[model samples]
Target: MEGHTGCTTKIVTLCTFKLSDAHVHYRTPLTSYFISHTSHLTSHWQSITLQNLYLIPHTSYPIPHTPYPIPHTSYFILHTSYFINNIYYL
Candidate 1:
């Protein structure tokens, strides 16, 4: 987490299958989350999960400083991504 302290963009990839598998398995696409340099990734995602759970569609609720509203379809994706990211970090 050394170089990550600055304002830099990072790409976090979440895979559906293990890397040991060579077979061409279908990958589940995930929605990308752009976290700010000022925030911790895991903690921010956890907060996002909460906001998404309670947010209604078409509401003006933004994910913290982000302008995007929580979409109905993103509920499952956010939870899955958060869990995956948490596991990866651990």
Candidate 2:
């Protein structure tokens, strides 16, 4: 989709695969980036939205953006709802 002319989409997967640190060390850069950010195991879960939506370990606002290669085009508050406990984007 990177080179394709029109791919206005962000894929979200309900990932259930178990992970091992040893296994992740060899992942491709794109996947490794995602796994690294989400690998933080947390007991406390909450969602907050500013320019982007984030699922952090605490109930706070202004969550950090997932560091990845693609650049964000634009931002707006797109409303949020309760989720199953994972990072989300607005």
Candidate 3:
């Protein structure tokens, strides 16, 4: 379990247990365990996305000893715009 305190902060709860040796002999309730695991995974993924941000951009690495050591104008422009957008949103 963990929590944070900001606009993106979130509280998360996790539960895990192992069946005892004697309890494992009874397999009737195994189906319910699978269902609970699936639901917990789905909720965890949703909560993670809600607490984080992502960015995407086209990128190129320049070769050394070349006349141009940086990305081309088009790629540079795309990366610059991405940075500006994130800054504005934040």
Best by lDDT: 2
TM-score per model over all chains: 0.16, 0.18, 0.14
Write the residue-wise lDDT of candidate 2 on 34-63 in tens digits: 222332322121232111123223223232
Positional deviation of 6 in candidate 2, in angstroms? 26
Q: Which residues of candidate 2, in runs, are more than 4 Å off?
A: 1-12, 26-84
Error of 3 at 77 (Å): 19
Candidate number with the higher TM-score (1 or 2): 2
The digit string of per-residue lDDT tens for model 3 on 1-90 reads 233323321122312222121111112222311111222232433332222222112233322223322223211111211121121111
Supply every candidate's count of residue pairs whose N, Cα or C atoms clash at under 3 angstroms: 0, 0, 0
TM-score ranking from best candidate downward = 2, 1, 3
**Which is better, 1 or 2, measured by lDDT?**
2
Query: Residue 15 in model 1: shift from native, Å?
Result: 7.2
Cα lDDT of model 1 overall? 0.25
Q: Give the TM-score of candidate 1.
A: 0.16
Off by over 4 Å in 1: 1-62, 76-90
Model 2, TM vs. native: 0.18
